[model samples]
Target: MSGLDNVIAAETRLSEVDGANGRLVICGHSLDDLAGNVPYEDVLALLLPDLLGPNPQAIRADLGQARVVAFRQLAHLDAELAALPVTEALRALMARLPDGEDRETALLQIAAPAVFVPALVRRQAGQGAIAPDPARAHAADMLAMLTGADPGAEAVRALDTYLVTVSDHGLNASTFTARVVASTRAGYASAVVAALGALKGPLHGGAPGPVLDMLDAIGTPANAADWIDAALVRGERLMGFGHRVYRVRDPRADALKGALRRLGAAGGMDAGRLALAEAIERDALTALRARKPDRVLETNVEFFTALLLEALGFPRDAFTGVFAAGRVGGWVAHAHEQIETGRLIRPQSRYVGPQPAGRAA
Candidate 1:
């Protein structure tokens, strides 16, 4: 009924999306609690308590080594695959990975995006791919691979906050798509690829790029109120202000905003741009509250998400892929959770068409 809204599909222990309260809890920890405080690999261990080995350090080493393996295996260019968009290129390249429900496949999927996305970026620019450095941490290595030099401490710190904040969030569209595929006992690769396809749509993972576009258009803080009025007059949806869930400010948005500030203090952020983003958020919030008096429309993940990822040196187009790099861990965990259910996710359908050639019309 109504696209299965309010339907309880499956019970999960990984993450909880408390849209009513605008809270996100991962493995019994808050998004605010986990974002900057925990390294990404530690969060990975927390999500997969049973799967990861006893030594968390070894698991970190394993993931680091896996990134190296993905780098070696996938760095060589396939013209057509490299020519695809970053997320699609990742999806295509993932098709070649050894597919399974085992830990090995899960580990590879987690690491592949970090390698594959930058490779796609390089090949698009007619440059060579950078090899992974196993010694570097995941967030650092990912940025290092892009810049061909070690990223600053704040840059890696910002990226780690991003990856952890987005590591898991209830059953979003992409996570749901992955679980549906996994429910049928398809391999992890199939589920992840399907999720990537679903995330490619604008309503979901394609949001952050346009947030940047809006920023580019506004240019300065002085323009915020005027731009808001004109956009509302033209019936344009403000890119980063609303979310399907979250009646209050998205907690992730707050987390990323804090990260943006940290990066600013580290000298990677532009002061004027930060001021402009904050001004627009304020103006947009006021306009939205006045427009929909009964509904809450506060800044969602896309707002600061665009700013944080842009500060991290990713192109607008690669934002989705960078998102996948962080979210792939959750996809793998959700796939395993769905598989444990041991039931196919076959939802019922009702049709309103004329029945049996007008026999019941």
Candidate 2:
């Protein structure tokens, strides 16, 4: 009963995570099919066919305008946002959006992270936020806004792959949070703010940034095995080496690793870091299997996510916010689905505490 391990909470047509098979299906396409092949805006359309329609070009234009709207809405709050953590700033700004289930509100909800996250990043560093260009693609605009420069084609593709790879997974903790709020008839902004709160937990979206810390501690490829062995002996949880759902290596890991490789091939990334990470992954898998034969511990998406985002110039603290930028589309779609068809999500809990004097045991 604890952790809702086998609980069937909600029915969704959005996406599924087959942990046993290490497969991820989004809409009707496999993750492998969509990640590198399909753009992020196309994935948004796939998730929100009824709301966003099937035309990716139109969705891109609408989403671009949504980004501008979100940017303008948050422009005056720059100083306040700079003082909060990135995820908290995102949640705070999301709360300020007008609450409604209307199409425009949903688009704004989805665009909130794309605009607010980078703006907060800039504000935190004592720089003015860059405005979103209504002409560029969503992922490109996120990169450009963060760095205040035009992002390269390969960097844009790398970011798009990250976004597409993470767009949705069935009933994740944060997605479930969004659905719960949506089922209460709350609008997209409210639901997405709730989801952002859930994602701030260490067990969920917060795990990715620590992966860079792990890599830093390891220092070199030659130190990987010994460092991993010592960390395992010390009972320290290795960031990015395991997942709660997957019994096999996470499918997103491969997708991101492929993106990182492509970025390096384009001379946008340092080859040394990639080599060190691969060595660490090989050693970690071997050590995990040897140390815990009864459990399945394999490389998950966070390992390569840290590398890809770092290569794309995101600081470690911004990892989860970037994750939200990709996942907001799925959150909005899931919220819409719950609003359209689902009832209020209120499950009963058994009373296990000491009963009052008059209460039955």
Candidate 3:
């Protein structure tokens, strides 16, 4: 019998991952090229293709409008889960989005998180959700909505950098799940919802929040090395180091780390937290390399993820929901790709159990 591993059909057009070389290309542009240069909405247009119908500026305008419209729905959902954790409350809200038949309608539904999560976080803390400013950029509006204060040029730049860097990656588990669902002729909203579900898993998008938790548990930089070492001895997977794909380090990590440094320089952060996190990264990387010489364990995206979110004033609990804000664009694009290809996704499973005994029922 053919091995199960050989049966999974790999699709190239959907996304391309060069794991060994630490390279990622989404659509046609290299991730590094797009992350710092383009606005999140422009990248979204690129991913959506002709379906967004050739107007980058207009598409962005529409997305901004959608975010405002979606806020009312988010407020309603937030009230229902006022006591629940932000991620769970957000998930429940997302699941309730009305299914749409066409791609554009679907795009609106997926774009809701960029507005909703931030709004819910503010409202839950007894702060008012700031209204979206159509005149401002998407990342700027999101930050403003969360904090009820307009972000400075540096803070807005940092948020834009973070959103752009994470806009897409080649067929990560969530995006792959999205493509699979879309291939089945499910609408875009369905595909995005499926992706969100996958992203919530601990091994994937759920990781970044734990970096803060780890820092808190360790208490200070003086305890960082010992805490990490103890966790290693106990066989715990350190939350922010190592990756399933990158053998060296996640390229996005440095980009976000640089953004954090810039934000810190602009006086937007708690200097103590920033210093402690940097020390942890250095000590953790050193310990990992020394302990596991055979394996290429290194800092992944989640390391700087904590710093960036902290600098942005996002509480630790809201990290994954913020991730969904960046990833929804990719999810929408991949869904469009799968639907355009017009193929059904079906993969075979292998049976490992002993052959059934001769029928004796």
Candidate 4:
């Protein structure tokens, strides 16, 4: 055996990720191309074949309705529940959604994050939530609802790009958790909750906020190298650099970095943070390469995810919550796929203790 005991079946239906080549293709289109051209909701439709049929307009309409319903549910949640951290609140809200056994239910489950997570963030920050607007595109409406201020065109576009870029990956840890949950015939909510729990770890969706923390400590471009070196000396892993899957550079990093630049321009944010972050990326890569020549350490998506969310007026604490809003689509789709396959996922564990003696009885 090659030691991959989990029996992850490789697929070629839509997206294919070649980690060794550092390439990602979605719907027979390169990630770079789709990230530039497609809206977030359209990409969601592409990823979910059953929930969203061939008609893009109809899918958007259905998703809009789902968003409205989910938003109302979010508004009714008690202040005590809303006081929890955005990520936990989001998971709780998602857990309450019905199982996606049919098209309508699946759409509702997919739309929960677009509605609830942003509302939870606003509520936690002492801002009242805004209801979803069916007329507006999903990403634009989400930003407007969360911030209670209409974002500029470029800002909305940037947010859309980010959401589309992260909508799905082949089978990352969180997606795998989602699939595993679905394989057991659990409801859509359960799978998404499992994904969210995995995402809460520092190694997954938790990395972006710390990138901002690292930048705050560094304070300026001149101190970037020293701060990184000091942190490395103390056995700290740099927050936004390097990825487990990609060898050369993460393609998502470029897409998000572009979005961040656009959003920064729209928001009139000072470029100092961006510049310092770039310097840190370069220095971190160099230092990492010097220390371990054989390992591939390059800039990953979290690097620019920090800058983008900060520019979009999100607090550091809300980063992972925002990620859930994008990834919930993928989790729902994966859950449906696993459920359709109807497999019970029960992986065997190797017991380390002494084996049962043949004559024990």
- Give the best candidate by TM-score: 2
Candidate 4 error regions (>4 Å): 1-7, 10-12, 356-361
> lDDT of each model, Cα atoms only?
0.87, 0.91, 0.79, 0.80
- Candidate 1 lDDT over residue span 165-227, tens digit each: 988988888999999999989888999999999888988899999998999999888888999
Model 3, C-alpha of 334: deviation from truth (Å): 0.8
TM-score of each: 0.96, 0.98, 0.91, 0.93
**Candidate 4 root-mean-square deviation in Å:** 2.4
After superposing candidate 1 on the true structure, give the runs of residues whose Cα lies further than 4 Å from its correct spot: 358-361
Candidates 2 and 4 compared: the better one by TM-score is 2
The local distance difference test score of model 2 is: 0.91
Please give the lDDT score at residue 92 for candidate 4: 82
Better-scoring candidate (TM-score), 2 or 3: 2
On the 0 to 100 scale, the lDDT of residue 265 in model 1 is 88
Each candidate's root-mean-square deviation in Å? 1.5, 1.1, 2.7, 2.4
Report the candidate with higher lDDT, 1 versus 2. 2
